[model samples]
Structures are given as C-alpha cells and as structure tokens.
Target: MFFVILLAQTVIGQKITGTVYDDTKTPLPGANVYVKGTSKGTTTDFDGKYEIEIDAKHQVLVFSFIGYKTKEVKVKGKTIVNVTLEQDSATLDEVVVVGMAESRMMKREHVVGYSIARIPQNTESYAAIKENDFKDVIKNPLSTFSVDVDKASYSNVRRYINNGGLPPADAVRIEEMINYFNYDYKAPKDDAPFSINTELSACPWNKDNLLLHVGLQGKKIPMDDLPPSNIVFLLDVSGSMNSPNKLPLLKSSLKLLLESLRPKDRVAIVVYAGSSGLVLPSTSCKDKKTIIEALEGLSAGGSTAGGEGLKLAYKIANENFIKKGNNRIVMATDGDFNVGLSSNSEMERLITEEREKGIAISVLGFGMGNYKDDKMEIIADKGNGNYAYIDNLLEARKVLVSEFGGTMYTIAKDVKFQLEFNPVHVSKYRLVGYENRLLNEEDFEDDTKDAGEIGAGHTVTALYEIIPSKNNSDKENRLRYQTSELTSQALESNDLITLKLRYKKPEKNKSLLIEQSVQNKPVAFTETSDNYRFSASVAEFGMLLRDSKYLGTATWKSAYMLAKDAKGSDEEGYRGEMIRLIKSAELLSSNKQE
Candidate 1:
C-alpha cells in the first residue's frame, strides 16, 4: 500500500503540456501561459508549445496573448490541456473603423455604434514619420530643433519586441530611445536651469566620420521640495477602451500614481464618452479611498468627446490654479478623438490655447489598435506638456511613480538648440532624430514661438553625424555661380561648432541665451564616456531598424556589443533591458532573412 501511494504521487507530479492556437488552428508564438493566481508563468516557444508543472493546490491555468481573447482551463485531473483562443473581435472591428473612415463616410457617431463582435482584429498603428536627410554644412550651416523629453517611443517599441515582432520603422525615434536611459551628466551649479555637456568621438558605425553628442541635464528637485500640485485627471472611458489592456490597465496605472501623491496635492477627475462630465471634484490627496473609488467606478461606453473633456479639465485646473505651485491636467486616453474638435489642427489649437493659461497638459497614451499616435503626440507637443505610453503596469510605475517629478513639473519651456558647424571643419552633417521637432533658424530667438519643454530632472541628448571637409566622397557639388572658398575667419578658427541654446523659465515669456563653442578634437570611441558610447549605440540601433541609407556599416551585432559594454551603473536595470531587446531584435531580423 505504501508503494502504491508513492507511485500515485510521482504520477501526479508530472508536468502538464499543451499547445496554444488561434481560431483557424494556427499556432500562436510567444503566448503567455501560467498557473492562475500566481506569478509563475512561461511563454510559448516558436512552436507555440508550453509546459508548466502543476501542483495539487494549483489546478487552474491561464493562457493569454496580444490581440487574442484569454482562456482559462481547469486541470480536473487532466494531464494535457490545449487552448484554442478566439481572435478578439472587438479589436478587429476597431481596425476596420480605422481603415474604413473615408470609404464608408462614417462619422464618429456611426462608427462608435458598431458592435465589437463583428470581425477578427488585425492591424498595427504608428504615426507617419519622415526621416531626416543629410545637408551640406556650407549651405545649411545651422541645425536647430526643439528638445523632446518624451520617452513614449522607447516603451512602445519595447512592447512590439516583447510580443515577438519588430516595431514599425517610423515608431523607432532614436532620440527618445537614447533619452529614455538617464545619463550621469553633472548637475547644474548656479542659477541656470540646466547644464550642457558635449563630446565628440570617432563614429563607431563609420570610422571616416565623427559623432558629436550634446546632453542637457535639468536641475533635480527633491520630492519633498516640489510645489503643491493641483491636478485634473482627464480620463477617456469611451466604448473603444473596453479591452482588458485598455481601461483596466489604465485604472491600475493611475492607482500607482496616486500612491505617490502628497496630502497637499489636490486631484479632480473628468471623464469623456458621448459627452464630458466631472466624476470627482477637487479633493485633497489625503482622501485616497474616495479618489480610488472614483477611478474604479469609471466604465467604458459611448463615443469619445475628447475636446469637451479637455475643455472641462482645463476649466477646473484654471479655477483651482495654485500660484507658485504645479497646476496641471493629466490626460489619459488612447488618443481616439471622434466628437467635436476631433481634427488634429482643432485639437492642437485647443490645447495650445489652454496651455497659455498656465495649466500644462501631460498626455498618457493607452491601448494599441485604433490608437491615434499622431494626435496624442501633437496634443502633448502643443500643450506645453510631455507624453508617455503606458503599455503595461511596470511601465506605469516607471513613468508615474519613479519619475513623478520629471513627468509632472516643467522646469524649462520652449527649449531649443542651434548648432552652427564650422564650414572649414565639417562638410556635411545630419541630426540623428527630431525630424518633427526641427525649428526654423529664426525660430530659436522667437520667444512667442511654441517649442518643447523639459521637465524637472529630465535629460535630453542630441547627436550629429558629421563628415569632415577633407572627406570629398560625401560632399555636395560646388555651385557653378557661388564661390566654394571659406571665409578667412572660418579658416583661422579652431572651433568645430558653436552650440547655442535658448530657453524660458517655466513662468517667464522672454528667453535666455547661452552659447558655447566646441573644438575639433575627436577622441577614440573606447576612450569616450559611457554616456557618449551608450547613446551612439542606441542611435546605431535606430538607424539599423529604419534601414537608413546613411547607415554605412552599422549592424545589429555591433550595436548590441557596444550597448552591452557601456551599460555602466544601471541601477534601474533599464540599460540591461535594452541589451535583451537588442538580442531579440537580432534574432527576429535573422529569422526574417531565413
């Protein structure tokens, strides 16, 4: 009898194995499988096969994948349990709405009324981005662009990689990817809002050219010293946000942010769907339970009236304006604005006008299919605010809790950079990213012109790939009428470039100018600081992803190696995560080739 009992226990301890498939019986790779009610989980391999050890106590298993409905199975003494998840019809119907907008002449009201159970979902959304091209320094000597502190692109790209796919080329914004990782630049010493650091080194991808890295470090503000905040949460509880990863994830994300709020801070809730309404009046942070209940009670329904919601949110913020304190509106949505003032230009005008009234807007993007990335980006850019995409709960914590100061407080506004390359030293150059943020040469000195804003404790980095004047291979043809000779002063100067920065204090209208010159001294790549090396690695990675024509010899292997070596003092493990992401991307690329 003892031997029989031992044999039964051994048989029961065997691992449970199964395959996950879609409705058409096609295997789903990278699907998440785990024991229900626990963190123990494993992802399906390339063949969609998963194995998990089930103990006597854990009898339930859950299977989930992006764009598919989740499935839960009870073991019930079964050894093998296969799951066939149905395509999430809701997301698919929304994809139709995105593509059929003009063809069906469907307005917001008609589209919102379509049932989610109509189709099978298949689509990816990304803002259209036009890459920058190299310019002759002799003709276009100055490069000017606003500083973008938004890190949405980095996390959004990661979401694609983690789901076993490569991000759309336009989605890979190199500057955001590099700025997502904080650098160890020196802090500001005097009354200046930020300090600038510049480094020039031999380009890793092309040994013939040089790479110039410019970094800006914003002054750090301790959490306790931050001003009291008067915040309005503009949430989108529209019908489209009914997915598990949309509304539910947003609620959980906001709760994490609430944990970091102080008693002196006050928050109000404004929701939009069909029409706009105030869900919770301005209440002190000490009333955490009431705020949480308000967030929980929000349900998805009706068409989205994002413009009305924004108007109401700004009105509340203006009413409760905190002098010398942080008065901001946090707009959380999927960026699908279908009602009044839904056009991009109209939304931009609304947010820009409201921002001028001292209430900044920070946009938190959620969801995937039917996501309006272009609209979200424009709203943040025009509203004197920042934008971040919350793809998962962990990213939520990073943006809202870990970097609260940087996300909520604006230290500098209309920050701009203009680099004047010496015609004698550089022949041609290209700014790695910021294609959309480029400013006119005259716009740098215009205080009234809108530009990017830097939050407290935020760091912005920009890179320029330069071809020296001696490199005749990449030079532009000399004009027949104009002289090709450099000026006597340009020939005599030792300066390679002049970096000019213009920024306005958070409340001031006028701008302050700071100028610095960098000498033409290129250091070996290995001797450069970890900040320079790591940023170069990220830029190279982006170029490879974009299939850039300027990518002379950049490869995924080289980028991965460089990033892995220069990951110094990665306290937050963000750098380490980049290394892993590169590996996955490399594998995906190779698989495509095969």
Candidate 2:
C-alpha cells in the first residue's frame, strides 16, 4: 500500500514546462501560465520559458499575455506544451475617436471647412500636451515646476497598447511613465520627510548631449504607525458604468482594499447617478460585513450627477472629520460627467474650494471608450490628491491594496522644485515631460500659490537633457549691446546645478524649503545605475510613441535593449512587463511602417 501511494503522488506532481510565443514567432516574455481552477501560477522569464507543477485533477494548462489571445490546452498526460498566442482580433479592431458622445449609441457632428467633422463622437478626451523646447542657459538659467505623483498616464498608455493600438500623442506623459516603477533609494536619515538623489550620464539617444536625473524618495511610514483614516467611497454608478469592466471589476477591486484596512480606520459609502445619496453612514472597520454588503449591493443606472456627488461626499467627510486624521474621498468612475458642473474648470473650482477645508479627494478612473481623463486629472490636481486609472482587477489591486497608504494619505502638500543651472558648465537645457506642471520663477516662494502634493512612500523623478558649454562656444549672434558674463561661482565652482525644493506638512499652511547643489560629473552610459537606465528607456519609449521632433537618435530597438538589460530586482515584474511592452510597440511600429 505504501509503495502504491508513493507512485500515485509522484504521478500527480508531474512538472509541466513550455515557451510562449506570438504569431510572429517572437518569444513573449512575462507571459502568465497556470493550471485551471488552481492558485498555482508562474510567469515567463526573459526567454519566454515557464514551469509549473500540476495536480492530477488539474491537467489543463492556461497561457495568457498582454496584447494576445489566451490559450488553454488539456495536457492529456503530455509533459511539454509549447503554445503560440494570436493577437486579439476584437482588441485590434477598436478604433480611435477624437470626440465625446452624448449617449453610447449616438454621435454628434460639426462642420469643418467644407467637410463634416464629428464632435463628441466617442466621448474620450485627453488634454493636449506641448513638448518642451531647448532653452538657452544664458537667457533662462532657472527652471521651476511642481512635483507630480499621479501615475495615470503610464497605465492608461498600457491599456491602449494592450488593446492593440497606440495611445494618442497628447495622452503620453513621460514623467508619469518613468515614475511608475520604483527605484532603490535610501530613506531620509534626518528630520526631512524625503531624500534627494542625482545622477549624470551621457544621453542614450544623443551621445553628444548629457542627461541629468533628479530623484526624490519620500519617507516610508509603516501601516501601524500611520494615522487613523476617515474615508468616503465616492462611486459613480451611472449608465455609462454599466459595462462589465467598469462596475463589476470596480466592486471586486474595492473588496481587495478592504483586506488592507485596520480596525481603527473608518469608511462611508456615497453613490451618485442621476441622483446622489448616502448608501451607508460612516462605519468602523470592525463592521466589515456591513461594508462588504453595501459594496456588493451597488448597481449602475441613471445619468451621472458628479457635481452633486462631490458636494455630498465632502459634506459627509467633513461632518465625521477626525482631528489630524487622513480624511479623503476615493472617487471611482469612468469620468463621464454630463449632468451637472461637468466642465473641467467648474469641477476644478469646486474641488479647490472644498480642499481648503482639510479634505482630499483622489480620482480612480475606469473604462475606456467614453473615458474623461481630462476632467479627472484636473479635479485630482486641484483637490490636493492623486489620480490613477484602473484598467484591470490587477491594477485595482495595485492602486487600492498594494499602495493603500500612499494612495490614501498625504505626507507633504504644495511640493515644488526649482533648479538653477550653471551657465559655465551648461549652455542649453530642456526639461523633459513637464510642460503642464511648469511654474513661474516667482511661484516658488509664494506661500499662497498651490503646487503638487506627495504621498507617503512616493518617489518623484525628473530628467533634463543638457548641452555643455563647450558645444556652444561659437556664438551665432552675441548680443552686441549687452553680453552676460559667467559669474565667479560658475567659473570657479564645479557645480552643475543647484536644486531647490519646497513643501508643506499636510495640515500646515506654510511651506518649508530644502536646497542641494550638484557637481559637474558625467559618467559613461554603461556605468549608470539601473534606475537611470530604466527611466531613460521609458522616456525614450514615450518620445517614440509621440513621434516627438526632439527624438535625436532613439529607436524602438534601443529602447527594448535598454529596458531588458536594466530590469533588475523587479519583484513585482513591472519592469519585465515594460520590456515586453517595448517589444510589442516595436512590432506595431514596424508593421505600420510596412
């Protein structure tokens, strides 16, 4: 009997191995493989190879990857099961519409010159973005901008790519894409809330130029040490959110977040559609069953009364306000607000006015075809909060569960950055991917001015493309009347740039300042850290997607190689997924060219 049992155990624990590939015969790295109806799973490596052990009862294996159709095969006692996935035809057939739609099935039109142009045809909108141009250091030595922790752009771009399409040029925000992945940086050892790090190396695209990386690592506070939170779930269950991915996926995502809450935390439920109402009063985490039941009971119908919903949510939060606690509203929706106060400026004004009362509102965007990204971004920015787009259940887990504290609590507000470049060492410079966040020089010191906010455990990164003074030695048209001479500090000192930062405590009204100086030191591209290389790769990818005019020598092939080589210590596999995305984009670009 013992011998027979051992043999059965060995037979049931058979190992299965295979390599996943796409239709083009290219290996699909980061593909997921698992046994049906089982929790056991593994992801393909850089070589598209995966191995998993299965029980006798679960002989069927499933293989899936982004941008490709999922395939399932019954092992039928076979050990090797190599599989090829086809591109999802339904995803590839999705078309890009530039305007909005009053209803899901209705289209609006306008006259453009002699032709008829569609207006609000599909309802998706993205705020237009203009790339930054090279600025003469002699003319403008100082560059200033607000720090942004919102990461909506990267995931939204991922959605477009995985759906077999390129994201609109205006939708690609390079800074957000780079900051999506975390970098290893030491925590602050002093009284400061964050630490600053800098790196300089040869530009990967333009070898003649240099790239300067600036990183800020926010202090990490353990969950036990975090302040008590008072949260209001401001959900939109309008007719627009009736789709399976919107309402059903959202409910599942919020359930995962419940597992992360502590007993000391409290939550309330407020829903809006054609009308706004309170579904649940402020309830303690101890009563989790009630919360779960309320979430599960939500249904989508009626029009979107987003403005009224905001007002009611803020009112409830203020009424149950916890002193010095994290008071926030997590609003989930597809951002389709056509009923009341729907304009971006109006929403911004409303949020700005209410944020002064010590309540923050973060936006969780969902759905795709009729998504209103522009409005959500504005509201989140003006409300002293962050924004994230949840494309799938996994993304929901990432935003609501994995990053609960960072997404819910704010450590610093009104965060701003100013850098003064030394004209002696740098002639021309361009601040990449912050055209919208750029602030005037005078706004840096103004306490009344509103800037960006940084949440706990958040990291903000910015890059600058620089042209050394040696390359600009020949002046085209030196000002004949007035010539600006380099200062003694610029000539004698080896400083490259001086970085200045300002931020306020979440509950404080005044801002605090911190400053640091970076010396002139350039390392070879091969010698830079993984963080530097990975971020550079993302920036290059964004530029390629946008078809930027400043793309000096960047190619899709270079971006893929850089990301694949620099994918170090990716515990969450996000960096590996980026490498795969680069490959997918490269194939799409090549096919388009052909």
Candidate 3:
C-alpha cells in the first residue's frame, strides 16, 4: 500500500555529504550541519567536511556558524551540498557595551589610526607551576598526588597555537595534555569502580632512563544505567562575555548539551552579572522548549557577581537535593569575576565549604581575552569535579554529547595515587606534571583529605621518569652519620615500585584501596603500546612549550614524529587533530625563534 511504501522510503534514508566554507572560500571548521527540524546533525571536522543522512520527511539541511548567516538547502534531489556562508552585516553593526564609558557599535573589521592593526593587550592569567624535581629513592621513596582528569589546559594551549602564538609557560600542563586523548585499557570487570594498568619502557627523551606509565580506567556505564541528574547551570552574562566567542558561543554550546539529557534528568538556570538571579527553576528535561527559550533570552551586560551566583546555585541545588542522584552545578564562564567575593582565596573557601554538603561543581570555561583560567581551575579542584575548555562547537560536542556520561556522572571521588620506589631497582624518580596536585605522603591514607574525582568512563594517566640503581652516585656522597642498608627481599624481588590508589564511592565518605606492584622489567621505547608512546609525545610537547629544564633530549620534531605514528584508531579525529596541533606549534615556535 501507499502507507507501506512511505514507511519503506523513510527507512531507506539518503546520505548527503559536503564541505563548508567561509566567504573567502577557506574551510570553516566546526560549522554546524543538521536536518532543518530534527536533532539528527553533525559538525564539520578539521577539514570542514560533514556527512548526514536524510529521509523523505527531512529534506532540508541547515548549515550554520557563529558570525555567519545560516543557510538551509533542500536535499531531495541532491547527493551533495557544499555551503559558503557569508558574514552577517547586521552582526557587524550591533552595539555592545564594554564599560560605563564605552557603548558603541563595533564593526567586525576595525580600522586603526595607521595601516598597522591595533594589537589588544592580553589579560589572560594562569597559575604558576614549579615543575616537579627528582627525588632520591633512598631519601624519599614515596611519591603521592591526587588524580587529575581535567583537559582545559590542552584545549587552551591549542587555542593559542591556532591563533598563531605560543602559549604562556604556565598554560601548559603536561598531564592534562597527555590525558586529553583516550587510551584503550581493559575495563573493570569486578565491583571495583576502575581498573589500573601500568607499563615500563625506556624513556623516549632519555634513552639511559626509564619511563613508568600508570593509567586508571573508570568503569563505563551505559546512559540508561546512569543515575538521574539534578544539574544547575551557573552561567556568566557579565559585560566581559559580550564577544562573539563568549555569550553567543556559550548559548549555542549549551543547546547542544540539551539533546543528550533524558526526561528523568532535571536542570535549573542561574545567571550572574551585576547581580545574581534565577532565570528558571528546576525543570525536567522533558520540557526542553522552555529551557531553550530561557537560554535564548539571555544577554550579556553588567559586572560579574560570580560569588553571589555560586551561593544561589548551591542553595537551589540543596533545596532540590536529589539523594542518591547526581547533584551538580555546571558553571560556564570566562572566569572573570570582578565583583563581590571575587578574590581567589575567597572563592576557594566558599567552594570548599559547599563541597562537603554532597554537591559537586564542574567548570566549562569559554572565551579568551580577560580569561581567568587560574580561578576556574581552583574552583573545579576544590569542588570535587572536573574542568574542560570549549574552544569551538566541535569541542563542545565532545565534552557535552560524546562524553555525556563521563562529564555528568561521578563514579568515584577523592582518587589518590602513591608510589613507593624500590631503591634496589630505581635510584631516583620524578613525577611528570601534576606539580600543583602533589600531596603529603601521609595524606594518601587519610580519609579526611580532599582529592580528585573520576567520572564514569574517564581515564587518568600519570608518568614518572626514573634512573636505574646502577647509575646512582649517592652512595659516594652519603653522610658518615647515616648508613643505609638494603633489605634482602628488596634485592631479590623483581618489583620496581608498589603503587597504591584510594577512592570513594560517589555517595560514600570512606575510601577503598587498590594496590599494584610494578615489575622492574622494561621494554624498548619502540616496543611499548601506543598509549605509552602517545603520552610521551604529549609530555615532550609540553616541555618544549614550557622550556622545562628537565626536557633532556626532547625536541619538537621528535614529539611530532612520535605522535604521528601512535595516533591509532582515532575514530573521533581527536588524535589526528592533536597531530595537526603539534605541527602548528612547531611552526609557531620556529617563527618565534626567527
């Protein structure tokens, strides 16, 4: 019958594919492409290419990008649709108020007094990082630190490199860069929340030394199995966020997140400007239209009252406290908090107090100029949550859609790592990155100490560079008053280190323990897994950026080569993008030298 044929036509959907370009014919990466009226959509990749399926009922495909005019074309008779989006003239003449004295319509292209373009002063800030130093195994055998799954530093650095500039030294966090990519480790099969994997291999930067890779793979839970979420959105609509990359991009990025939520999940909207106020009360995801409307109604103006916003958000979360559920605040901002309770210490103290009440806060940082990365990182760390930077729609999709469960669900909290090296096998060792996350040795076993949280399906990686016992010269310089002797078991055992991990269940206060013993046996660098090689490459890249004294023989060319070969099975093209970013960094670094 006609109805049966119509159903058959709908089932056999047609595929449409094409590339998106700007007015200059330059490929526009991260452009949005979708069926006009449905959630079936995709973003253009690094090459500005996209492919989406369409049925008879959905024949129109819409292409859109920030600052560009959206275009919709019919795909009924076409197999391909290439789009060239022109800049919106209306947006160029729109008025934005930057301060009390400055309120004027700015053009997309502004003219300077002379032909030379005016370069704006950079106001971005990052926390100072003192790189970890070597520790003698005989003197300090144990290395303790909290696990970090934050990926903000990596994307922030990428934004810098893509803008044709080298990032500030403190902007590069090696561990975050290494962990930005996914690794293939076996998932936990038991009741444990996560599985630990370790690898020993020759150090790529120093052939005479060794590299120890420790990875934790949080158990993956299906979307249906995840606990219902009570999410409060703490959005910043201050005047500083008036740029195209700030408020507008944030609104679009959050809309993409809405598609991933379920009917059982609830969301509330809170905004901070000259003052803080609630835009929408807690509402179920089933009423997505109301949520979307509230988001679209937001406009950037006034000073930032971030502290007041946090207090109100936490208050609402407490009022709607969902016991045995995921209660969290997803704060999106450029981190420029200039109003009341704006100092770093004050915000930290406030967040520290609220975290004890079973409410977590994840941070989604956006924008560039006047950015406050230092504050956002501190907030996320103290709030028992995670942090990520969204530089584009593609990155937003990665964080809010593809990794929805990992971004929203906490499987374990207060995850800590402590490694005790065997002096008989290793003379000295230094933890790579995580300088700020290092903890006192005794703090590892203390249940009251705060640490990091690992979300469902999140992978945390750490690296340590070690020197073999045979290369030690400390014995010759040992103090005459103190003579150390090795144990017979230490000399006979093949273990190089004993790794210990502690973590708590999402709703529990007490911590569970996981212990692993690493063997002294090591393989050649080339024989190691892609996970080891790729992570080493990222560490080397970070060193080059920071100009670290401990870089050894690491070079930009070497990092690029290592990453090129180890970018295995990058289905999402994230690894491939990292490879490109490496190449971009090399060019920028070389130009700086010139």
Instruction: Estimate, for each residue in 1-594, the C-alpha lDDT of model 1 and write its tens digit.
Output: 999986677567558898887665745555667666544566665456789887666678877654456677898588788889775523222221222232342333233213334333535456777888888887898999999999998988877665546677988888888888899899988888899999999888889989999999999999898999999999999998887678888999999999989999999999999999999999999999999999999999999999899899989999899998899999999988889768888878788888888888999998776777778888888998899998777688889988888999999999999999987789889999998899999999988899999888999999999888884333445689766666677779878999999999988999999999999998888799999999998998888777888788888889988997898977666776676567667766765667
User: Model 2, 1-594: lDDT tens per residue?
Assistant: 999986796576888888888776656665667666655566676567789898777788877665466677898678888999886533233322211121321222211011123223466899999999999888888999999888899999987776556788998999989888788877877778889999999999999899999998888889998999899999999999998768887888888888888999999999999999999999999999999999999999999999999989999999989999999998999999989878777788878887898889999998888999988888898999999998766678778877887788888899999999998888889998988899999999998889988888888899999998883363333788887777788779999999999999998999999999998999888899998998899999999999999899999899988887888977776787777687667766765676
TM-score: the better of candidates 1 and 2: 2
Q: Name the better of 1 and 3 by TM-score.
A: 3
Report clash pairs, candidate 3: none
Instruction: Compare candidates 1 and 3 on lDDT and give the better one.
Output: 3
* Runs off by more than 4 Å, candidate 1: 1-33, 36-55, 59-125, 471-477, 480-485
Q: Rank the candidates by lDDT, best first.
A: 3, 2, 1
Using Cα atoms with residue i matched to residue i, what is each candidate's TM-score against the true structure?
0.82, 0.86, 0.84
lDDT of 3 by residue, 242-354 (tens): 98778887999899999999999999999999999999999999999999999999999999999999999999999898888999999999999999888888888889888
Q: lDDT of each model, Cα atoms only?
A: 0.82, 0.83, 0.85
Using TM-score as the measure, which candidate wins?
2
Clash number for each model: 1, 2, 0
Residue pairs with clashing backbones, model 2: 100-120, 100-123
